[model samples]
Target: MSSPPDPEDLTARARIRDAAMRHFGEHGFEKATIRGIAETAGVSSGLVRHHFGSKEALHAACDEYVLRTVRKLNEETWAAIKEGDLAKASATRRPSGRYHRYVARSLIDGGASELFDEMVGMSEAWFTGFVKGDGEPDVPVRDRAAVVTAWGLAIPILFEHLSRAFGVDLSTPEGDIRLASALLDIYSHPMMSPEEAAAARAGLERAARRSTTEGTST
Candidate 1:
């Protein structure tokens, strides 16, 4: 009988998946090839087929992996938040490495609706539970969460534009510093005072009411 596949060979499945995600993230499905993925993973194309059967199946597996990862992270974040350990929650959201590349790719490639919807639901729950826990959101929590999710997803899609605007490649250390500094400034220094923000929200509520009254009349 043929000797069992080497122990190293048994671990090829995860390597292939990681390599496929990298390829699919950098290049779309049509551009990424099984041979290229196998080469990156240091495995055989036959092994890729043996594990996932086909490119589409590999892609589906990647989606499942991403979904599972996000769900786990969100759960950890939620638990941290409940315990008032915001630092832990923040850390939970900051995953290390190129894994997130596939998240951006999945958003762009379509057919990740389950993943997207799951994120939206988690975002809605977060906004409802914490962001506006003491008061009403300017918009409904679900709508607000959806918009926030869109904005978060837009980062990868708009990465090039942001890099150009910042005049630095976002993949570099300097770019990370610059971007983090900018975000810090934006979050720390509110553009509007409490009164101004309250007034704006009130105005929005008034406009919403007016629109509702007009619709009722019609």
Candidate 2:
């Protein structure tokens, strides 16, 4: 009749996960050792294994945590939209930038493929749902959504070099707000007229045709 694990121990498990995410973000998945993470979390390597089973499983847990957080933000934003409060809905959608460095490192390392795909899939599904009906997105919409997720969200975090150039640290609260405001300004305003859009499409079509012809010629 051994006693159940203490509630504090359960809490320590969360701390371990947090430490692991930070290490993975800073050192990358393959480079981040289990012992290093455990030491960072103030726990033994055996305890970390006891809680998370293995490094791969622990990484999965971290990805799932991020997914759930994004899903919750989406749910809140959706509720606000249903209430006819677009401003409120947009304001409600704020994902923490704490893990931004980790994500950027992961991107550069070319590891964490599972986490990346899952995040992109979730974004695609969410955007698809917002369109006219519950149908899969057409190629253009899906392509746009994927690009937006990468450039609009991930790139900003990945390239902190931009922060220095822009005179703002995007990891901070005020800086994030400033970046968001700049993004909103661009998104809210139309950059081109219908005629320009048509011309751009024609140009793209010509480029595609040229590429196809060159490929067939070879």
RMSD, every candidate, angstroms: 6.7, 6.2
* TM-score for all models, in order of appearance: 0.71, 0.76
User: lDDT per residue, candidate 2, 12-35, as tens digits?
Assistant: 888898898899888888889899
- State the lDDT of candidate 1 residue by residue for 1-218, as single tens digits: 11233354358798899899999989988899999999999999999999999999999998887787788778887888788875565556555225657777777778579877888998988776665333555567778778778876776667778889999976666666676568658756879888999899899999999999999999
Highest-lDDT candidate: 1
With a 3 Å backbone cut-off (N, CA, C), the pairs that clash in candidate 2 are 25-102
lDDT per prediction? 0.78, 0.71
RMSD from true fold, candidate 1? 6.7
How much is 129 displaced in model 2, in angstroms? 5.2
User: Which pairs clash in model 1?
Assistant: none
